[model samples]
Target: MKITSLCILAIGLAGSARLLPSQPQDEQAKSSATVEGVFVDQDGAPLEGVHVLNRIWPGAESSTESDGDGHFEILLEWDGNKDGTWYEGYARKEGRAMLKFRADLRAGQEFDFGRLTLTPGGVLSGEVLDASGAPLSGAMLLVVDAAQQASAPEGAQADGPPWEQVIDRGSTDASGAYEIIGVPPGTWFIVAKHESTWWLWSEPIRLEAGKRATASPFHLESLPAEYQIQGRVVDPGDKPVANAQVATSVLSPDGRFMMQTTARTDESGQFVLFFSRLPSGTVDLRVQPEGDELDDGSLLDVSPGARDLVVHLGGTKVLRLHVVDDTGRPVERYGWGLSIDKPGSFVMTGSAPAFHEGGYATLRVPEHPFELEIRSDAHDRKEIGAFTPDALPKVLEITLTSSQAISGYVTFQGRPVPDVFVELVQRTPNYLDGVVEGHWNGLYYGLESSTTHTDQSGRFRIPNDFPHITYYARAWADGYAEGTSGPVKVGATGVHVELGVGGEIAGVVSVPRGLPPGGIELEFYREEIKASSINTSVGKILRTITDDDGSYSQPHLDPGTWLVRVHPSGTLLSDLGWSEAKVEAESHPYVVTVQDQDTTYFDIALGRDEPCILEGRISVGDKIREGYSELLLEGPFALDLDFSGVDEHGRFRLVARSSGKYRLVINAGPGHHQYKTITDLVELVPGTNAWERDLPVDQWTGEGIRLDAH
Candidate 1:
């Protein structure tokens, strides 16, 4: 077989060589390279009419068609630089799956690919019919990857992955027969949709290479007549209010919230909302005029085909705001903005130009009860609730009192660090209260108040507009550890930041034999010191992906205890026969400490031990909530696992490497307010393991609690 394959490849190369055009010696020496290949099917038969493409350099692509003997040759042009050592080649035919291969070639090198076999693609065929048993032409058929469906919430229609993930797509013919070609072998779900009908999904189907899978005929149920809600916006005086915006939220059939079609009122204040498909429950409709709010929104029952709506907008009131600094002068050089607490709220912002006319800014708003917030960089943020425009004073006075400047110098190991980014950040008071339960000690700060870059002298200045607030002056450079100053009052002067010479962590991510290169990710987390007054922002954590050679570096790490972890990408893990885990073991986080300007080296090997799956449920006071959980593994090794779409019954699953202890941190959602940190070590053997627990909502604190393994 090997001799025959080599002979066939040699024949293909010789035949392809004859088809190449003779080029000038000078041109060939400067830019020409040859890529010759033979296209064959799984049965080793020559496949003709195969399209071949060579993408070796930017803006230069060579393309050709396979001859009758499946021999193809293309001459590629090498750009000015010849540093690139690899080029990608692709081949595909009408009925066969596409094949991608990479070849290493030097400049002017002639590359010859041996017999490249194109796997026969799977075929999906089915018929589409309406409720009346008549063929439904033009019905769209989509093949979605089953893996995407596995993560989607139950009852939610999975929009087949991104355009690239679509295995195949087609439309039914006049006879309602649909056939999709060139689908890669895998498990997939078929979805059919037609105009005027509801979407229908098929059960999962496993397709084999070069095989055909027939799906049960889809009988799409006709959707009810689309409902239209027509309305007109008028002022209290019965005059039309033109250019008003209307919006409404509707639940999709998949049990997810989606926005309804929005429409703006025309010149005559006329608007219409069309609903092609309405959810089973009530829909909430909100209307906002050009500058007014609709206090009484409509709870629409869209089941009744069409209806008319009328919204009465209250009269408008002009509120004049006067802003001035403590010196009684117009606060001209500060950023100011205002926001309303209503749906489709509008924000009016600008510089001193907004208050140009004698330091007074005018605003036109509805004469209704609403919440308003006015904020300024040089003043405290003010929130007014239930304020009626008509009841406001003729001129509202806003005092800008907090104007200060903080200047600092950043240095690393007694040497000035120039071009470092300096920022003033304030901690949001009570940010962790109520939102996070338990002993949540992680400090969360608000957005940056002021930002600046250090000059050549390593000097930075942050002009603070809110003097009443205290902030931390943080400094970070490309090759230095993040440094921060002690709490400095906004009005404080001469704040200095001493940055530590950062360290580097170099490591090799060794993958098991038979695994392709790349896809391994490394994450480094700086340990939080309980006694330290300075809190590192989450953004400071370092993450990197392994190179093709399985090496990675976490550079410029702070001089402190840090956690290092290595894990395969989600797709790779799933492909390795590992099931998702619900909780991560917390016992073996790789801990390392670094000194100033030092480099640490560590190596990790994967695939030696078998992997296991952990499944469990998260419940609050006996009731399971449908949410996601983040499992943090710590032991002899560390990894992070994220699981989503816990059913309404509160079940979840995660995958982990076996023979390791893990710490599982489960958060109901992204919000840090509610979470459970499990410190008790969960040991996983080489196989499937399960755990179940009911976390009392009120009893579980955000602190890491040790739970004895049951």
Candidate 2:
């Protein structure tokens, strides 16, 4: 049996956009690309009712539930390739205590992930007590990893992180007892904190899969007075706005330091909110004055001054949003966003978004004019509303087109070059890539990217939601040089790229006996410019890793004198029994040629057999750097498997079979940070290495294990 369902939301930067009139639904059902996968429980039995969600950039989401047999298939947004899309998402059960199983999707291809297993988690119950042994009521209980909660503020180095994960949490009742189900099986410590008492932790408890563990009582002490935010909400005329919804929020660009709490004002329009401690940065106090029957209220942005705040609110305008196709028919599912001076979501605590399903919504938006961005999986995006405050409309209707696509081909000397990976990028300001780049923190910028593999005919199509903007298409294939189509502007029927057969290189890598294949990295570099007859290193151009048989190959090279370097190269030594290691051992740079239509062969025997030890003493803390966890040597080579622990005197050692210049990353408390890294590269020869100075924990910042196997 087969089943399918879709949910999509379209949101991007606040800008201007337009929609084409609606067409018949059947006319919009052209692309037939599909992807499928399966889900099972820890017992290997098919798990049903799993929600599989898929999303593309510019806010397009599609979702479906698993059938009885655990199989699910979803229709992809097919433009044939005119606009290739980067797809990502995960599959999760509704209420099971299982961790979310992420789906590994190729940039633009469709495939199955065989069988994904979801493990049902265990449960945890606990009690809270005061220093005097009396039960404490209304204490918030949190379950987290024990490392960060250890008796001392010492640090440890872990392959991944010191995991301050909030696995599960619950609040204590009249008896000070709390039970939280769905706590994933793991070693956890319980933390109890009440408004009137200090935060305290219980001893670490390692839980069994699908079982239960009761935590010991936590004895907390009396807490001092916390920072209280004083505020009031009033109408423009100075009249008190009674029972106004108020909230104090602190958001930091870095994930550190965040808190949010909601409350309502009394008859005097006065409200008080408290935080465990005074936050360091900016704090936003939002107030929504209660509106009468016809209005739904709006939020007032305020900043606290001297712990006291006053805000004036005149309510807001009602915006009725309707999204339709070319034929004026409602789109099935869509998401919209609003932004004015900056990008932000208008979502608040109590509003329900059920109305988003029918391409319709009634929103109580800020009175200030703002841009409304809407989208659906099949439709093109455009900013629809950016009205002047006085001209803001009560009802806004938008029309969109779903038949948008961009098609093209890659050819080598007039012959089609199949199997090429085509990449499309738009450079216009406020475009798809522009919007995603700002919010994603430099993860993907300026390049709103779409990717797809060329078909047998060398033809490709990418669904173009922003066809009105200019784009550039680049392609690279096995037998042809990389090609680019510059300035594929709006209304361009196709993007044509011409490739040439440049130089090609192939080689086999020989490593130590037990070294598995595919972890080695190779970087290609070219001289800054051919100013002189000889080539001199400037910047890197390309990089590739070895295949299963320790072989690597690449074609489509630009004709130039190339120098291949193994600077900072390593291989991942993965599990023979669930452990992994990153072995850094590579050869020096080898000069190669990229002459037209030529092929070069080079063989490499990596790292010497002799062992090299780089040992050092290290400690961590905000103040006294004592206690040792584990630290990371990111460059050259890493020995995550061996003992790199520090002793009571803060001494440690790291031994690797191979050696090179390495970087030191002080990994502690959840994870390491930019500040924890040592900029100076420590070169290790065939013997012992040292820092010569006392190693310090400059900065410490702070996913996954699958236990489905029975």
Candidate 3:
């Protein structure tokens, strides 16, 4: 299973590999770990129906229901990087303090927390209103602790203190009123938000033990009309092609995925696509064959415009394939399917064709540069190389080899380790090996099929059902570091992995004692050049938050320089009760070096001296309509700048600290889709100063995030 591994920063199980192993050994074949616990309220009564979850990273995550007696029994099958790792245990129930305890969990073991008690929490009530003085329903609200790291929203009063961890969250009702229970008693702030348009926080709200507090009503500005792409999809003959799929990807200037919104054409072959905010990347559209009528089509690169647009699709062609084993016998389908992949295409391409036991496929495909893949279980997975539309024969005959099994052992410090997850991954792009899965994302045959687990003796078997491709054998287990072997071909014998003791980064986060707060989140990205683009592709090595004591630590980080910032969770990213990321006191990319088997100590402070302001207005084409912003202003890791706030007029103000002389990556969706680094757009001088410039939006061009190389 060559996954192209495009998001390699997912490093290990972060998001790279599947959560479960294909084959399990001994105890793993059973349950990897069991955590049992009983929950009670401060009054000693059973707190039934608490949500208990086993939080595992790069591993399987499972949750359990609490019995009427408040007892929860969570079972887990872990493929984690570290052994006997300490993971965050979460339990939540309305009107109760959310429990975030660190628990020691070892695979193949059962631990019971005899009696767990939860604290009774207070409640906070508030109302949200739009600029018209009318109630705004469906608005989300959260109360954040005063000490956690949190970046303020644009236009938020600068006089208020910073914040961290959400004590509680709730949504507004039809009356635009909200009441959030289970709030930990302390000093906090009320944050009212509605997607990207309206997000801002209150001054502060103080609550006492088991009490109720009312916050000041929140008033937000009116939002503008959303961006829309109105167009018609047509066939090569100039006839309307209805029911086609039109999609576009939103990516950061550095090629980071931002979001995606799609629309489907109606009966007239006309489509209207709307985005809450205009996207900053080229839009792509495709038309799949409609019952025996039209075939698939493509609209490669298109910069959406404000008016009428037409999409001419390349119609489909007929293709017949007869697949057989190397011995001239017809291949049997073990349920694996077949598909045509345009390796470099951005939008989802090709029709999903399947094969029965006879191994024959007759499918219509868009006339694009694509490779054929026969991913059947009973045969050695076949990759039929790339073929141009005119170069393909009317009927193609391909021979596959009998499927072969892959066996391997996992060892750490020369000792066999059981229950480790082992999977095969692509090491490089090979046209003859498989289609290019994704250019910027990397290329791979598939994910999860070529995966298995080690048994007590540390042996794993990838069931004999993978294509003959080069792959890196990666092994991981809880309580130890993840390990990967150099590239090896399929059907190789005695594949082995030797795990290592990875390094750690530990530190304390501080703030001006009398000032705002400590901070809410901490996210750091490891630097590694993507094999496909020779450009930086990112992933988080470790995820952690500053504890109440102001200390934080990240384990199992691959040795390298990492850029640390106060980003959110799941992006495993974080908050000060923060929805936005905060640039820390240090310089951007706050570089820290971590080495194998060593612990790097690095402390950080919150709130620096007054920041430097870099102000600019973007004059890109009128692609972005009024009352909306489709532009993003950002550098590597913006310190104090609120990059999310590029107003409808394309005007932006960046409050930065020590950014040096650097040009920010203006992720303008139009004008250019490819990137060539820009420099010195603004020279940020020392404390409390401001600089302004009007951007020549048309002059900016970039390499699109998609991988163009093989």
Q: Against the true structure, whose lDDT is highest?
A: 1
Q: What 10-residue stretch in candidate 2 is worst by lDDT?
A: 701-710
Better of 1 and 3 by TM-score: 1
Give each model a TM-score.
0.45, 0.38, 0.41
Misplaced by over 4 Å in model 1 are 1-121, 125-139, 142-191, 198-249, 253-256, 259-274, 278-407, 412-418, 424-452, 455-471, 506-523, 527-539, 543-555, 567-589, 599-710
| lDDT of candidate 2 over 1-710, digit per residue (tens) | 01111211111222121111121121232233456767778676888887676765434667887899998878777432222345564565533453333332322334455566677766677777887989887677666776555552222111112224555556777888777655666788776676555556666788777777888777776643344567676776777778866665554334464446556788988887655444565466555444431112333343333345676664455567677878887764555565543223343112211225467666555555567676553456657666655785556888877466666888988988787777665432321122122311111112323455577898875556575677677676655576768677544555798887777778987765656655355666532122121221111146677777778876767665455654222213222121223233232344465677887887766554444566664444432233333322342122122334444444556554446644333222222221222223356666667743333344332211111111
Cα shift from native, residue 346, model 2 (Å): 14
lDDT of 1 by residue, 615-678 (tens): 8776666434445554554432233433445666767776564456655555453233444444
TM accuracy, model 1? 0.45
**Better lDDT candidate (1, 3):** 1
| Candidates, ranked, lDDT | 1, 3, 2
Q: Rate the local accuracy (lDDT) of all candidates.
A: 0.59, 0.53, 0.55
Candidate 3 residue 426 Cα shift, in angstroms, is 18
